[model samples]
Target: MWISLVYLCLYWAFFLLLGLLLVVFLAYCAYVKYIHMKYDHIPGPPRDSFILGHSSFVVKASDNYKVMHDLFLRWAEEYGPVYRTNFLHHVLLTCTSPDSIKEYLMSPTCPKDPYAYNRLFYLFGKRFLGKGLLTNPDHNQWYKQRRIMDPAFSHKYLMEMIGVFNERAEQLMEQLAEKADGKQQVSLHAAINRVTLDVITKVAFGLELGLVEGNKTAFPNAISLVLKGMIDYMKNPFMEYMPKHWSFIRQVQESADLLRKTGRKCIMQRKQAMLNGEELPKDILTKILQCAEQENGLDDEIMLDNFITFFIAGQETTANQLSFTVMELTRQPEITRRLRAELDEVIGFKRDISFDDIANLTYMTQVLKESLRIYPPAPGTSRYIKDDDVIEGIRIPGGVSVNLNTYIMGRMDKFFPDPFKFDPERFHPSAPKPYYCYFPFALGPRSCLGQVFSQLEAKVVLGKLLQRFEFELVPGQSYEIMDTGTLRPRDGVVCTLRPRETASQ
Candidate 1:
């Protein structure tokens, strides 16, 4: 009799548990439906699934290896300037309006999207760029670090870097000279990447990486791997737990760890030097240490965070920009001729380009600006909306992710009449400057601190290239952009270089 009673009780308990799960599932469905209804007024592409939202569309496009910005461009054409996209429960508002761009990015109170920035804090379950200026979402904390590091990027300090920039660019030219035989195909992207890496390492940390001289360092490859891992982890959050992905995940983690480890070692050495009464150059490393000291103690991890941040941000975007500029120069001979003429006139045969020469390379400056318009390296940024806002007659609720994309705005027909044309004349001094539409380095107080630094570096490297070599693109190479964290030329900008007949003396 007792056994029968116990069996009956077990049967009732099992049904109750099942009933509770069903109720929870239904409640979740209701919540998703209600959330979707909130942004129903905002125009966007038709949803593929009620629960999944646009995630499947994104994943499918990613799987097909389609450039995401192309999709955004298409949608912008279809849905108008301010539209909404849903990723599961999260609502994203992609804004291309100049007015909205100014309000969202220029406001000091505007906060970075935690969901997006925090993900970058780790790459495949390993600490990467933790609470650094780039990934730090706290406005107050970011301001403190930015203030401490400001002197490192001041005009005086940047002027001091011009010599280092010229030295590195000269090294690159020497390396390219051996491979300048017209028959040999060279990857300008890869070569320029080495130069930028070497420049950042030497100028920022006072370390001579010698990447341009073909030093077999794992740092470059590690950075590439970490970027690839970032994309993978972002596209599929569960990738870290999947057994099939374990090998790549392990590699990404190790690469992240290696970078942090290197940063720790470098920081410790600098600290020791300070203790030994050795005077330190007021470079980025010294500035980083000062930031840590201001925080009441030397926080190696935080200092390392900025170290990795500088290493990646300082090198990658500038390298891609230079590479893209070379690719365009290869394609447009008229533009190339004009640029070479400007380089010849301003800096003819001058191997060491001075700051004054850089200032006077006006036409070269326009060309580089045009390149950034067409192919921005760090394409876009995101902000978290804390309060309700109205943009372009559409009401964006308080809790939304607003995407501000230079790539999208740069290509719009209304903004640029001939959007696809590689015309440097658009950026001529007499031409009207794009209002808020042309933010290759972003805008407002949170704008890129390295803007001047990057452009100066770009000018030095590119001016030397134009003065020394005539390069032709290898046939059948695609000019398509590849999004690997940063947008890069899909074909790696392969070219065959020949010494310019009127090469610099």
Candidate 2:
């Protein structure tokens, strides 16, 4: 009788637990239904599944290696400027309207979407870019750091960086000269990546990585792996838990740890140097340390956050932009000729490009602007809508992620006629400025702090390359863009470089 009673009790307990789970599932379903109803007014492509929503489309596209931005662009073209897409219960409202961009991104109140930015705080169960300026969802915390770090990118500070820029760029030119045989295929993207990594390490943290000199460091590969992990996590948040992906997840976590470890080591060295009465340059590291000191002893984790943040931000995007520019120059000989002429007239074979020379490279500036328009490395930004707002006659309900995409906007026919054309004339001085539509570095109070610094570095590197080498795209290479958290050329912009006739003149 006791054994029977025990069996009965176990059976009852199992059913009771099952009933509770059913109730919770129903509640979640109801919540999801309400969310769906809330966004019902917004038009998007037909949902592929009730549970998955547009995630199926994303997965399919990602599986085929399709550029996600291009997919978003297609949707924008089909569904008008203001439309919505669903990722499970999460509704993403994509706005390409210049007015909406001005209203939402410019406003100080609209904070970064916590769902999006918070995910970046970790990569596959490991800390990555935690509470950094880029990933910090809290506006007040971000502002404090931003305010303190502003001096690092000031005009005077940037001018001081020009010499470093030239020196590093010159190193790149020399490296390229060895490979400028016009037969040896070279990856400009890889070369530029090394130079940019070297520049940021030296200029920002006072560490000379000598990446351009073929110094073996895990940083480049580690950063790449971490970025890949970020994209993978975004595509499928549960990937880390999956048994099949454990290997990749392990590598990503190790990479994130490596980066943070490096940052910790660097910070400790700098702190020790300070204690030893050694003077440090007023670089980004100094500003970061000062910010930490001022914030009632902000922890080293936060400082490391900014350290890793600057490493990725200060290097990756700029290198991609330069690579894309070079790829375009190879395809458009006429445009390249015009750019080389501008370099000749302004710089005239001068090895060290002055800050004043950078200003006078108006044509080159236009070219760079055009490159950014076509291929912004960090394509878009997202904002969390706290209050309901009307955009383009459609009401955007609060508590959704609103995406403002430069890649989609810059390619739209309504924004730029002949949007696919590689014409620098669109950015010529006489041309009408593209109001809020041309924000490659974003816009408003929270815009990128490294915009000027990045452009300066690009000019020095690109100006020297154009002055010295005549590069041709290697045959049979696709010009497709790869979306690896950041957009870069899929083909790595391989080319054969020949010394310009007047290169030594």
Candidate 3:
């Protein structure tokens, strides 16, 4: 009788626990439904399934950045200027119109999404970006850190880094020349990556990556494997979440550890050199050390993170952007001709373009701007609101992620007269609307820190490349934009290069 009573109690307790869990889940679901019911009047994509929400539909079409942006475009057309989707009761609102995007970015009262960065942390944990300006919550700490780092990016200051760029650029040209020794369409993609990585290394720590010096190193292959790991993670959602468990991730992490360890040794060596009266100019590492001295010292952890972040970010964004832009120039001869004509007008054939001349080349600037607009390095930027707010008469709740689809707005007919067409003339100063529809580096407090640096590099490379090889998209090769990391080509930009001067024939 005693045993039977205890068994009954245990059975009832199990059912009771199950019942409570079901109730909580139902309550959560009901709350989500209530939010939808309350805001049902708001325009959004028709929810295919209330449980999964529009993410399912969005994920299905996210083959490319343009496709992901199309989801926003479709919703924008259906739902006024802004729309909302619930992610397990967490709201994600997509702002369709440029005005809405502008309003959100510009408003001082509004806040940047600290929560949205969790995804970034997921991509590259806190150990990589925990110390940098890019990952900082829009706050006073960011301001202080940015102030110290400002000198590093100042145009006057960065000019000293040009020797670094020139050396790497030479290596790149040499590599290409070697690859094209007899006749070969060298994987331009790999060639560009090598150049960019070389630049990042030498500029960041003054590390003479021996590739430039013709020294064979495992750094290239190791870095390639790391990049491949990242690409795989972004493609596979599970790896994105549980990064450490995946075997490839472990390999990449090991490589990253090696890089960080190498960076630390370099820093210490540089410090010793400085102490020994061997003064190096204010390269990035020098500036970072100066900041550390001012702070009395930097935590090694923070330093490592900054080193990794700067190296990865500085190289990845520009290289990807440059590669994609070059591909476009290859395809569009008319556009390419006009760009070259503009370059000729400014720099001429006999001379390498001066830095000052880079600013004056309006048409080339437009080409770059259009390239960024069409193939934004980051297709969309996400931020979660820290507090609930209202913009353009729409209410935004705290903890909701704002997916600002730069790619989508760049193609919005409401913003651009004909968003699909690529026309550099639209960027002219005399044009009726200059910034009315444009924001490539983004707007407001968290805009890209390397904007000027990137533009300078782009102009220099594009100016030089156009002056040499005339390129066109190789027949039967169509590269689709991969929406994953840095807007990469799904296959790769495969093109046949012919001399530009031979175009008249």
Candidate 4:
């Protein structure tokens, strides 16, 4: 009788466990149902698959989806400026309306999306841009660093760097001169990339990378590898774990380490020099070191973060912008002629383009603005909503990622008529200002600190090229965009240059 009771008790225990599991499963189903119903009222494209959702459609765009900006552009047209898309369980709402953009980006309550920025925090199990001004999602921490770094990018300081800018831009012209005979096709993007790379290294840390003169440097190649790794990680975050990608992942990690190690060495040298009472040049590094000393060892990692930050930001974005500008100029001869006329009147074959000259080249300024509108280098920014919000009468649920894509917004016919046409008049001084619709360098307090600095460098480089040489696009070269971290000309702006007859005369 006792043995029979034991068996009965065991049977009851098993049934009770089964009943508990059923309750848990039903509860989970109800929660998921609630989530679907919450966003069901919102308009969006149907999920392309149950597993990948609309992200499958986006990733499937493959080559054309280079930067993913094209995907956003297509969806914006289909679902209007504001629509929701999903990547797995995460809901991403893209907004192109000026008012909506201003509200979310400018609000203190909204922070940079942790999910998006966290990807940049590490690259293949290595510290990449940890707590840098760009990737730091913590608003208070970012604000503090921004305050400390502000003086380095001040108007007076940037004006002082014009000599260095001209020096580097002139070196690029010398290199281009060899290829300007019109027979050899030149990759303007490659050449400009070197110059901008050299310029940032020299002006920021007072180190001459000598990349413009065609000297091979580890830093340049390392940066390239890191960028490639960034694109790969963005496409597949689990790439590092895959057997096929191990080699590439290892290379990226080594490159990131090389960058940080080099930065640490430079910081040590600079610190030692300060202790030795050596007179230091007033460069960005000098200013950063000063701020670091004040923090009393607290800002060591922060210092390294900014070091990488300035190098990448100061070079790649500006080079790509200049490359896109050249592509546009080659396509539009009438605009080039007008731009050349303005360059002649203001610069007049001057070897050294000054800060004041940048202001005087009004038409060139407009041309640059228009180029950015059509081909934004960085493309977009994102914010994480902490609370449910209403945007254009559509309710955006809390915890969803909101993307403000300048590339998509810039291409919209509602914001810019004949949007694909490269027109400088849209940015003419007398023309209406593009309130929140056009933000190549982004908008508000968190906007690029290097905006003015970059424009100054671009004007110097492009103006000198305009004054020295006339370039034509090589036939049969594709003008596709390549989104490797930043968008660049896929064919690297292949061109054959001939010295302008007017300049020769």
Candidate 5:
């Protein structure tokens, strides 16, 4: 019995690898025939290996996804603005030119590449995200959804959401005050995560976990498991397919299922309370749910996907942006003081900072914009070409994924006058460049669903914090960003905060 079991296991392992070998051979043959021979005009890297293509180069780069961006930059330098690279024999073409981005992102022909972006399904799950607007490849559905949902960002609804924004910002200030009461090295890594997560819950679900009260969370383990599952599936297999029944895939599906179940319960509970004639709080979450209910009540899967997407999108990106902005401001006191002076002018201590006050925060918004430019949370955006296309006179064959790297784009001297300098003044309304040239949230129809939400949260959070706190970088500490699930600081951001006492006058 033992010998038979061992033999069975060995046979399965042999067959699994053999099957992979066969798939690579077929894909390679098709590549050589259709891509290399037929579309020889495309510029790409020299073949690295039989199966991996440039996969090793990608994995070996210090910043995992940034590798492709770096390579694209080098090739663009050599081959021109548009270039292609073979990622695990799956061809990928990249673009960085502002003109190129405008042409493609706005064009009807270029669709999001599912093969390149299918890795996202692990986080949002197959069922919930199967056809949701963000991940869906179907242009018609995206157009329809965008039409229906885009109005949520209209000025009136966005203004209605500001009260929750201010409330969350106020709560964050109180928490920051408590943390700085000790004046020790406080890990902003922890603080920002708590604030953003709380903001997402309150704004996206009409639920408040009140996370900062304690370190414990009911969903932390499950969320971590989901993210881990995403990395495992996307990395280990690469473009080489993995079995659908793989353990990590199963875990990701299960965790998304759990988050969805809880989210649905919360949504239903809110609806039931409304049925009981209870007044739901006025906020983005309430508005979103009301919109969902009014759209004849979408399928629960889509509802859950949007909720999870909002939580992740609405949470991590804003938090990281704030954290990095704080990190930069603390290090540069000159810039911070300029920022504070501007803030004082725009937001007087005569009363609490109101929505109207936030509008006049021109420099603060510039500071936030520069930070996002420096360390964009989602550094790269991707698309798949379904038909052969030419850009800059280079033929890009179909079935290729293209990653446009905003991080590298920010670094390019062409994009900004002094690329590496953190000059918020560059964002002054009088700045030389056009608005379409800079896209922290992508421009055009398929841009970030929560652009307004993100901007409001950042402005409110940073404005409130700066109003109350004098932040300075602690000496002997250097902050470098790491490419985590989001672009996060490699080490914790440590800053000393002294309360800005307003009553002395």
Candidate 6:
């Protein structure tokens, strides 16, 4: 009789536990359904499955991220300017309309999504760009840092750096001259990347990384490997915990450590020099140290974060922009001819390009603008919404991601008619400037601080290249855009070059 009572009690307990689980599962399903129905009014591609959502389709389309941006273009065509795509529980709203973009980006109500920016703060179990101006989500903190750094990027300061720009750009011309024999194919992208890296290191930290002089450094390859890991991490969300990827992960972490250690060493040496009562040049490093001393609660690690941040941001985007511009110029000889005509009128065999000359080369300026429109180095920006809002008659609930993509909008027919055509005239100073439809440097307060700095470097480099060499794109290479954190020509813009006089004949 005792055994029978025990078995009966156990049976009742099992059923009660099972019943509780069923109730919980039902409640979860109801919540998910509510969320789905809330976004149903916003148009998007059909969800493949409840679990994977549209990510499976996007993942299938991606090839080294060559097709990912294109997929966004296609979807934008199918579902107006605004649409929502989901990856499991994460829903991202893509806004392409000018008004929508202006409201989402320019407004103070929406803040940067920590999901995307925070990922840049750490990679492969190591910290990078920790609370730097670019990745810092706190508006107040970022504004403080920005105010301190503004003087460094002012017109007066940048004008003083033109000599450094000319010196570094000339180094590139020397390297390319060796391969300008008309038969040897050159990867302009790789060559330009080295020169730009050298420029940023010298101009910012006052360190001479002689990458352009053929002095090999592990820093370049190390930075590249770290960036490559971004794509890998995104592809396999479970990579950090997976044992198979441990080796690669370690390599990336080591590279990040090398960067931080190098930054720390350089910073300490400079600080010591200052303590010794030695006069120092008013370069970026000097400015950073001065800011550190003056600001309260700012730590050394945060200063180092800005160190790496400037190195990467100052170099990568500008290099990619120059590469894509070269690729387009090769295909559009008519445009190239027009640019050359302007270069001759303004530069006229002048090897040293001055700031005043850069401003005078109006046609060259337009070409750069058009290239950026087609292949924006940083393709898009995202924001996290905190309060429910209405945009273009659609209700956007709080706690969702909204992406503003320049690449998608730049290619759209609505904003830019015959968008694929390589026409520099569209950017002529007399022509109407693109409204909110164009924001390559982004919009409002959070826009890139290095905008003028990068563009000046680009114009200087390209003006010299056009003056010295006539480049032709090597056939049988893919012109596809590769998104390895930044968009670059897939084949690195392979081209055979001949001295300008010979090709002109």
In order, the Cα lDDT scores of the candidates are 0.87, 0.89, 0.68, 0.85, 0.70, 0.85
**What are the models' TM-scores?**
0.95, 0.96, 0.86, 0.92, 0.85, 0.93
Please tell me which predicted candidate would have the highest lDDT against the true structure. 2
Better of 1 and 4 by lDDT: 1
Clashing pairs in 5: 113-384
Clashing pairs in 6: none
Better of 3 and 5 by TM-score: 3
Indicate the residue-level lDDT of 139 in model 6: 87
- lDDT by residue (32-83, candidate 2, tens digit) is 7888899989979988977678998888877745588888899999999788
Estimate the overall C-alpha local distance difference test score of candidate 3: 0.68
**Cα lDDT of model 4 overall?**
0.85
**264-319, model 3: which lDDT tens digit per residue?**
89888888887898868667888767876786676666566667667776777777
Best-fitting candidate, scored by TM-score: 2
RMSD to the hidden true structure, all candidates: 2.3, 1.8, 3.6, 4.1, 4.8, 3.3
Q: lDDT value for candidate 5?
A: 0.70
In the range 1-505, model 1's lDDT, one tens digit per residue, is 9999999999999999999999998998898888898888999999999888888878876664456888888888889989888887788889888998898889978889999989888787788978988888799888887887777898877898899999999999998889888879999999999999999988888888888987889999999998888887888888888899999889888999888888888888999998898999767787667665776664567678888888998999999999999988877989888888888888888779998998998998999999999999988999988988898889888888888999998999899988999999999999999989889888988899888889999999998888889888899888888888888998999999889973433
Clash count list over all predictions: 0, 0, 1, 0, 1, 0
Sorted by TM-score, highest first, which candidate order results?
2, 1, 6, 4, 3, 5
Model 6, 89-144: lDDT tens per residue?
67888888788788877976667888878888888778887888888888888888
Whole-structure CA lDDT of model 6: 0.85
